[model samples]
Target: MEALEARVEALCEQGNALADLEDHAGALGRFEQALALLPEPQDSHPSTLWVCVAIGDMLFLLERYPEAREFLRRAVALPDGLGNPFIHLRLGQCAFELGDKRRAGDELARAFMGAGDEIFDGEDAKYLQFVRSILLPAQDA
Candidate 1:
């Protein structure tokens, strides 16, 4: 089990590096491998949260909407995932892509409201902008 844990950690690190390099396909594969090594029904494991989010986001980048929704849903249900505005933001994006307007609105609102006045910096900031542009206008209508 320790050996597997080490392997999972290594794979996650590699996946993150790949993602940083914009090799999303390679990142997805590494994350998938790490996820498989982790326990099943992974909500209890702290390590599973990030991997799930990585896979979910990668799948979204790949335009696999339903799979992205599923993984993001799983990620958000994990203890470490709920407070991550990125998870909510990604889930909203996935919902929007899937044409689930109601969910997209709800999730985007959660993400935006959760962000408060803090200035997001990086990809998250972009996601925040997307939420504001798309969801805030709907609020007026």
Candidate 2:
């Protein structure tokens, strides 16, 4: 980890702890604080990806789908972001909640393909069901 990464990681750890305790609002605040530490063009920082993901996840938990989508999309632009299943899953969920079924199906499929069904274990069944509705039919064909 880089010098600032250690500091941001510390804050992220605290945010993770708060998130684990279901204090998503507090976690979001901590993540935002950590993100603010980075220089201009935050995407250049390695820590930006996870911080954005954490903030987006918190926003998702809070049912702030639009804000969640914005942050998650930002993460997707960062390093290794596109390959992270959790990011895809949340983006899918946000799209679903936002009534964008096309994007939901596309993103959910990416999540499922990236990490398998286990990623969907703790998530709402409806999400997996929606993904299946799109994927299973293709398999059948």
Candidate 3:
């Protein structure tokens, strides 16, 4: 990682630690600060994906759906995002919460198709399970 990217990664890690401590506001601040260090039209930078995802996830946790959607959109526009199941999953969930059912289904389907067996085997296992339960049923409806 470049110096800035390394610093941003550290900040994001600190933010994650704060979130684990239930200090969401502090986490959000760290995420926002990390995001601010990147250039606009951020898809050019590989690091932008993680920063955007971090900020978007934090905003989603804070119930700022619109803001979350914006940041997550930035994430999905990055080159790495095309193959990222987690990005699609996050966008799908955000779209669901925003009452955009069609978009939610589209994103969720992409996530399901793109993901490997191990995608749901980590820290986000429960969330992926919940998403599968909800979105899979929607597919049949």
Candidate 4:
């Protein structure tokens, strides 16, 4: 079981590396493999939220907006204290792409609110401003 867990972790790392390289198909394959190796949710093991988030991110990059939104929603709905602001940001992006402007705005707002100063720097600040000025107003109007 320990070895299986280690292999799953290694595969997740490989998937992330492939994502960084923009090889979406390869990344998805690795992530799927990792997911398959893990026990069911009720069994004791590492949470699959991170893997789901990674898969959602790859789907977003591939412009599969609906699938991305589904996966990201699951990631965000995971147990409290396990959620990441970055996952919220990705979900916002997916929602925006899917033409769910209201949800997009709400998700982005949550992301901005939850992200610590350490994470929301420079370009992220610019993105937050853009979301607030453009997306939020569009939703309201």
Best by TM-score: 2
The residue pairs in collision within model 1 are none
lDDT score, residue 80, model 1? 70
- lDDT per residue as tens, model 2, 1-141: 387777788889999999999999999999999999888878997788989999999999999999999999999978899878999999999999999999999999999999999999988999999999998875533
lDDT of 1: 0.82
On a 0 to 1 TM-score scale, where does candidate 1 land against the true structure?
Answer: 0.81
| Rank list by TM-score | 2, 1, 4, 3
Q: What is the C-alpha lDDT of each candidate?
A: 0.82, 0.93, 0.78, 0.75
Against the true structure, what is every candidate's RMSD? Answer: 3.4, 2.2, 4.1, 4.1
Q: What lDDT tens digits, residue by residue, belong to model 4 across residues 1-141?
A: 889879989999999899889899899889888878888762234457777888887888888889888888877777642347788788777777677878877777677777743444633355466566754465533
Q: How far is 4's C-alpha from truth in model 3 (Å)?
A: 2.9
Candidate 4 Cα misplacement greater than 4 A, ranges: 42-44, 81-83, 116-130, 134-141
Candidate 4 similarity to native, TM-score: 0.80
TM-score for each prediction? 0.81, 0.93, 0.76, 0.80
Off by over 4 Å in 1: 116-141
lDDT per residue, candidate 1, 68-124, as tens digits? 999999999888788687788789888877888778767877876888535235444
Clashes of each: 0, 0, 0, 0
Q: For residue 56, what is the lDDT in candidate 2?
A: 97
**Candidate 4 C-alpha RMSD relative to the actual structure:** 4.1
- Candidates 2 and 4, the one with greater TM-score: 2
Task: List model 3 lDDT by residue over 1-141, tens digit each.
Answer: 488878888889999999899787899899888888877655687777887888887887788888998988988887787658888877877887888877876776677778844554543455466556655565543
Error of 1 at 123 (Å): 6.0
